[model samples]
Target chain A: MSNILEVRGLKVMYGKSIAIHDINISVPEGGIVTLIGSNGAGKSTTLNACLGTVPATEGKILFAGEDITHASTAERVRRGLVLAPEGRHLFPYLSVQKNLLLGATQRSDKEGIQRDMEFCFELFPILKDRLKQKAGTMSGGQQQMLAIARGIMANPKLLCLDEPSLGLAPAVIDDIGNKIREINQSKGTSILLVEQNVHLAFGAASYCYTLQVGEMVAEGSVEEIRNNDVVKKAYFGG
Target chain B: MGVIPNIMVNALVLASMYILASLGFAFIFNMLGSVNLAHGAFYMLAAYITYYLCAKAGLNNWVAMLLAAIVLAAIGIVMERFVFRPFQTEFDRVVMVSVALMTMLQQLAVQVSGSQTISIPAYGNGVLDLGFMTLTNEKLITFLVGLILLIITLYIVYRTKLGMQMEAISQDRLGAALQGIQVNKVAMLVCGMGFALAAVAGAMMGAYQQVSSNMGDNINVRILMLVMLAGAGSMNGILITGFLMALLDSVCPIIWDSYTASAIACSAVVVLLLIRPKGFFGHEM
Candidate 1:
């Protein structure tokens, strides 16, 4: 009934440049919201601000009704606001198992972590086979899967993903799309996905917000956004 | 009976001390991405502190080493929080800070302890006549101490949660932060461990050799060579290279003289460095 995550008047500046201005977005409880935009859009900046990796010039970010604008990235993560990041950011030298375990670094619940790790293995059996293998040795698709599964391992209440399908085969992108839906349905986890792949985002997310430059150009249900003439021309190639 | 046995024993002792000194140096380097020049300063201070605690305060040798370790560990924590953390991102600032620390500590040792040589009282006395080869209790104890500490250090780095976190931080700081790891907290622990290892090595070496103001100078250069040969951010690399250096240090002096040994070792390092800049066990620089 209530929004699980909210960002209001989120303004981010980079030296002399205004990266994002007055960006307002929200993810309702158990809702899957997708933010779609082009290269120079402020999608990544929004995610980074929410994670507190980049300091916000002006804004308020709310997680479960609590303002976490000033919290550190670790603090934000501890409170179940996790980001998988754009590049997958795997510790390449470390084994796959170590990377997965690091996902729950702040959590002390041993039993819960054990259960979640098992769940991750079940979700990505490829990962189970490559426990000792270095993550860097994996293919692009496998690495992306690991990054997403790593986010799940954190047991996040609101998982903010930045470009889950940036550089992957079409089949792998489809698998990721299905997995996102499956995660949303099964785990009831609220997700804020940022994507350049409009089809994958539209297929997975029930709600959609279109970002152009630094501002939200459109926001509505997936069907409503699909039918919009401006969005169709800009994103869907009408 | 022969210098061969003594040489072998000396190599092991030297390897252990070098390993101990470099282990902390490697940890700090991995965590901070800086070449901790003040590590030698910390090592020198620990030797001096242990000297005062044992020789001046009339404490037992083992007790003095333990006290010195705790004190140095505390100092390391303070340095990490106040000194290293502030200039963590700025390489130039860290260098300035570290150079200031090294110069100050080196001077402090010269002024307080003077240039005079003072040896720690032996933990035990007399030689163990083990049939063929005789052994001094001082060398035997120092070797044992070094071996045990090396094992402990290996255990802490290779088989612990803290170690995993350390590796994670070294490889990817942002990724570790995203996982809710308290990076600063982990850095403090590592900084303390680094200080503790250096302190222990300083104490053991001071007991074996005589403590002088310039004791840290040779060791400082030795550690630099060890770390460089090991490459950046490679723990196992340091271990292998440390053994190789100890071998050179021990056998060369026996074959020629100490100065000749130093010259040979330096030459070998320079040649190998040009061939493989990243060191033996390291990845791309």
Candidate 2:
């Protein structure tokens, strides 16, 4: 499979402190690729850098072979590199339907947008029922679902999910993981998953990369990483 | 009865102008979470521009008002891009910038007009005699203009895609940006709209009252009170609070001391705050 997104020698700095250092990763088309790491391991920094939320001090980002290193965050989103963000940042005062509509802000194809919106509602039926409800009032799991649904509304070529299972109940996490897999398989959309939960990451992802202190320490197939001694000790607490 | 009608007309005129100014202030506040202390300065500058166009350039009063609104809107866009956008939401810097703007505009006005009050020629010269009272047609026109503008503003805010984007940004800036809404572009539009609205109100008030460098200071206080009383992001609340405050400003002087009207109005706002800090109809805290 051809790589849809490639990050080369990406570096990010927050003020004087370096957040991510010379990290490189590539996501191939139509599969789940996850970055597994501990808290503050710069998984979010890497994702932010790719999304153009945090400027990469020195690096190159190629989306579908088009360089987007200096693009604005909104421009990056318009070009289909969308990030769901770590906190599920939904517009709290807006209705669920409005929030979903906003996800398609860059697209002018009304019919296509409408179809994707219907697909989102179908995937998250609860969101359909609560279409007019304020996003803030939704439960954490429901909001997470809405966040993913909102991202899907963009009709993105590659969907970047930042810890969709964070703070979710185990069953809810399982449901989200299953839905994510369904999204990848059915929609044929590639995904870049960033997660601290190794089990969920390994189960949902075909390939995984382990990050430590702003650097990629290991990258291999899920099965390969699962069998690695260091992966077992660091991720599974074996 | 004649006195009562006169006071009622005055109340409506005051309320309309207050609503116009406060609505603009509230727009910037809602969209950017920026206090926009420079709003009063914008209002003052617009009034002077209207004065210069009509009085000095000999333009028609109505045409001058439109020109002033457009000019001020452009200026507001520039201000947002250069001044406000850079120091957004920084309390001290916003205050400093606003105070500096106010002083600079006031000094310019003083230098040009020599502290003399200027007034636009009245658009409507006659008065309408109702069965109960005599009312100036100018006051009636001002009230209707304000009402129409308010309706238009509401429609633009609630019914349009731009309105949806504004609401989205107000709710979550990062979320809006992630959705591809250009925050800076939206901020410029909002600032332009807000300043234009305030300018129109300033010109109308300048025609009805006398225009001076410091006229905006009084209106600015009233705008602040109206926004606070209505709660941020609540448009309808502004209309209701504006009328209520106008009623207080009108009726209180008849029953109580003239100075007590300001005190009473302020007390009402304070009491409302004590009861509900977010003001009535505001989204939950």
Candidate 3:
């Protein structure tokens, strides 16, 4: 598979404090790549920088061989890079259908948008049933599902998800994990999964990277990372 | 019969103007989360521009009103780009800039117009007798114009793609940007629309009352009260509260002394705000 995203020596700072430092990662097209780390490990920061939400202090980000280091967030989305942020930032007051419609704001293809809306509804039938209901009134699990469905409406080439299983019950997490795998296998949509749940990450990702304090500590196949002592000690707590 | 008809006409007229002004303020406040203290100045500038174009520049009053709206909208775009854009999150700085702009506009108007009350020629000069009552043609025209504009504005807000983008931004700015909605462009459009709406209100009010340098001061207070009473970021609430305020404005004078009417209105808003904090239909509660 070809590399669809490349981050070279990226450094992101917030005022005087450094949020991420000298991080490099490459994601190949059509696979699940997970970045597993503890809290304050700069996983979310790296994802945000890739999406152009946070300005990088130095280095470059290339999407599909195109430099996107200085691109605006909206421009990044236009180029098919979409982020399903950590907090499931759905428009709380808006209806589920409206929230999904907003995801296709950049695309003018009304037919394609409509098809994608149906695809989302097919994936999560609950959303279709609650299409007119406000998003804030939904359950946490349903909101998570809606968030992923909203991302799919953008018709992204690469979807960056930040902790999709953050606070979900184990059963819900399993369902989400299966859906992520199904999305990757069926739709050929590449995913950059930033997650703390090692089991879920291991289950969903083929390639995995371990991040510690803004640096890539380990990068290998899932089986290799599972065998790494550091991964076992920190995440699996052996 | 006479008192009821008079009150109904008064309420409708006042409601029309209040909705016009409040909607403009609501647009800026909801989307950009800025107070836009210079909004009233924009309104005053529109009245003065209409005055200048009609009285001095030899333009038709209707044409001047349209021109004034366009001109103020252009100024609004420029201000959004240069003034409000840089001061996006700095609330106090934005407020200071707006206040300074308001002061400059007031001073400029005073210098140009010399503190005199000048009225734009009425759009209509006659009166219509409706069975038991009489209505000035100007009042009827103003009320109809306001209603038409309000319907158009509401249509643009609810039935257009731009409207969806505005609602999305107001709800979640970062999320909207992530979805490829241009924040800066939307902000500019919003500012232009806001100022244009205020300008229309100013021009119409100039015809109803007199255009003067300090005319904006009184309307500015009323605009603020309407927005607060409606609560920020609630379009439906704005529509509801606008009429409520207009009703208060029309009826209070009949129930209380003229001097105490505004005070009573203020007290009612305060009491309601204390009880609900987020107005009647606001989502933020």
Candidate 4:
């Protein structure tokens, strides 16, 4: 399968300090890829670089066939490259429906947007009843679901989610994991999930990459990553 | 007019005018997260422009007010693009730039019109009898027009797609950008709208009362109080607080001397702020 996203030798610096260096990642079309790392591992920096929020000091980010390293965040989003950022950054004071509508800002097709709204309701039925409720008032798990649903509303070719399972309960994490897989299987949308939750990441992603500090340490199938002694010991707690 | 009715009318008229002027100031404060110290200058400039158009340029008072709003809006867009955008997020530097802008505008006003006080020709002639009270046609027109504009402004804010975008940006700028809402473009439009609203209020007040180069200096304090007491991220609160502020302005003088009334009113606001630091209905910015 052709890769939907390719990040080659990506390096990001904040002033004199390097956030991430010499990093490469790819997500195949219709596949789920995850980057897993602990705190201070530069996972978010890498994700922000691909999203064009932070400037990449070196390297190229190619979306489908286009070199988008120099593109603006809005341009990247317009081309179906979307990021549901970490911390569940939903508009807290806004109603859930307005939050959902904001996600589809790039599109104008009323029918397509309506269809997507129904799809979201189907995926997370609780969201339907809470449509008029303020987003901030929702529970953590529901907020995380809304974040993913918001990203899906963008109708992205590649949806990059940062830490969807962070602070969610075990059962909620499992449900979110299933939804990530369901989205890929049903919608054929590519996903690039960045998580510190090893179990959730391993369950959702077919291919995985592990980063330590600012550099990639391993890249393999989920099965291969699960068996690797060093990665297993460090991340899996085995 | 009875004393009670006169006081009530004064409060209502003052509330409407201040609410119109403060809406723009509130928008810039919430959306840009910067204090536009030059906002009062925009108001002052509008009054002067309306005065010139009506008195010297042979235009109708209403037409001149509209023209003043347009001119100030154009200047606002230019200032947002060239002056404000670059210094955004640097609060101190932005304040300095706005203060500089205020001084320049004030100086220009003085050079053009000097220290002499001027007023626009009344929008309406004769008096309107409202049973218990009689009001000059000019005051009634100012009140009615100000109230209508305020309604239209609120409607645009609450019932429009562009308004939704503005709300999203004010809440979370990065989140708005992720949705492909162009921040700079929206910011420019907001600046233009803000100045236009201030212009209308200034022009209306010019006809109702008098205009001087330093008039903005006095109104600036009231604008600041309105926004600060309303807190951040809450536009609806401005309406309530605007009326409350006007009530204080109107009623306080009747009970005490002007100086004592000013002191008592400010002290009351300071006390209320102490009780609810986030104003009546606002979250942390």
Clashing residue pairs in all predictions, respectively, total: 0, 0, 0, 0
Q: What is the C-alpha lDDT of each candidate?
A: 0.88, 0.87, 0.88, 0.89
Stretches of candidate 1 off by over 4 Å are A15-17, A229-238
Residue A101 CA displacement from its true place in model 2, Å: 1.2
Per-chain TM-score of candidate 2, chain B: 0.93
Docking class of 2: medium
* Fnat computed for model 4: 0.65
Model 4 clash pairs are none
lDDT of 3 by residue, A66-167 (tens): 999999998888888899999998899899999999998888899999998988887889999999999999999999999999999999999989999989
RMSD from true fold, candidate 3? 1.8
In model 2 chain B, which range of ten residues has the least summed lDDT? B276-285
Interface DockQ per candidate: 0.62, 0.70, 0.70, 0.55
Winner on TM-score between 2 and 4 is 2
Residue-wise lDDT of candidate 4 within A1-238, one digit each (tens)? 7889999999999999998999999899999999998898999999899988899999999999799999988899989999989997889999899999999987899999999899899999999999999998999999999999999898999999999998989999999999999888888999999999988999999999999889898889999988988787667666
In candidate 1, which residue pairs get closer than 3 Å at backbone N, Cα or C atoms, i.e. clash?
none
Our tally of clashes for model 4 stands at 0
Mind giving the per-residue lDDT tens digits that candidate 1 earns over A1-238?
A: 9998999999999998999999999999899999998987899999999999998899899999999999988889988999999998888888889899999877889999998899888778999999999998899999998999889889999998899998899999999999888788878889999999988999999999998888888899999998998888776556
Candidate 4's docking class is: medium
- On DockQ, the stronger of 1 and 3 is 3
Ranking by TM-score: 3, 2, 1, 4
Error of 2 at B20 (Å): 1.4
